[model samples]
Target: MLIRDYAEIFPEWVKLAKVACVIPVSSVPAERGFSLQNRIKTAQRSRLGEGRVTRRMHIASSRDTLDTFDFNSAAARFTAAKYRKK
Candidate 1:
């Protein structure tokens, strides 16, 4: 109520408030990420590095379903990489 009345006089504060309001009040997203990381870094594959973990997290959290994802291009890129061992 008070914020609405003073928004015109204090535009900067209003912008800050709007940004703050969008922030999550809970840590559910962070918790989910940690949980995904745990599943990706299990005992048998514990040697995975931070870069691998981050990339895996991004893939795991991607909004695109498997059917919509272009796996052929990804496979082509992987096979084209000369750095990979035979």
Candidate 2:
């Protein structure tokens, strides 16, 4: 009723309010993203470019076992591919 009443006086606000109300109140996913951003956008690397940040964020977000990941096999595969005759 209040929204309908405001529709005439503030049509733009009513539309925006309706949209805002439909959004989920929980911020768990957004908070996780914020934490990831903080980890990647450190004070030391403040000037890191957007493309680099996006790439690193993608890398960071994709994997679950990064700490124990096998770099040797990955490196070997990369070297083999890089040296493969194209």
Candidate 3:
């Protein structure tokens, strides 16, 4: 941390530090979904059910920034599926 007076003297350095801070400290989030598949798909979960566990994987492993699914389209598909079957 710099004193307010010192910060005026080193404005460029402060800007550089701000840019560097944006860089990720660790790259874990990039590979999180794949890395966590085994953890989420435990031996007990795998044997008890197949489709049940798979349905929840996307929610469990997806990045926090990407959760805006279009439920309207999914609901439309659900309605259309029944008519197509007949």
**Index of the highest-lDDT prediction:** 2
Off by over 4 Å in 3: 1-34, 48-67
- The deviation in Å at residue 2 for candidate 2 is 19
Candidates ranked, most accurate by lDDT first = 2, 1, 3
lDDT of candidate model 1 versus the reference: 0.88
Give candidate 1's TM-score: 0.61
Per-model clash counts, in order, read: 0, 0, 0
TM-scores, all candidates, are 0.61, 0.52, 0.36
- Model 2, residue 34: distance off in Å is 1.6
CA lDDT of each candidate? 0.88, 0.89, 0.72
lDDT of 2 by residue, 1-86 (tens): 64877789888898898998999899998999889988999999999999998889999998859688899999999999989965
Q: Compared to the true structure, candidate 2 yields what TM-score?
A: 0.52
- Residue 65: error of model 3 in Å? 6.4
- Per residue, candidate 3 scores C-alpha lDDT tens digits across 1-74 of 74345578999888877788799988887677557666777777767465656666676756444367777887
- Model 1 pairs whose backbones collide: none
Error of 1 at 71 (Å): 4.3
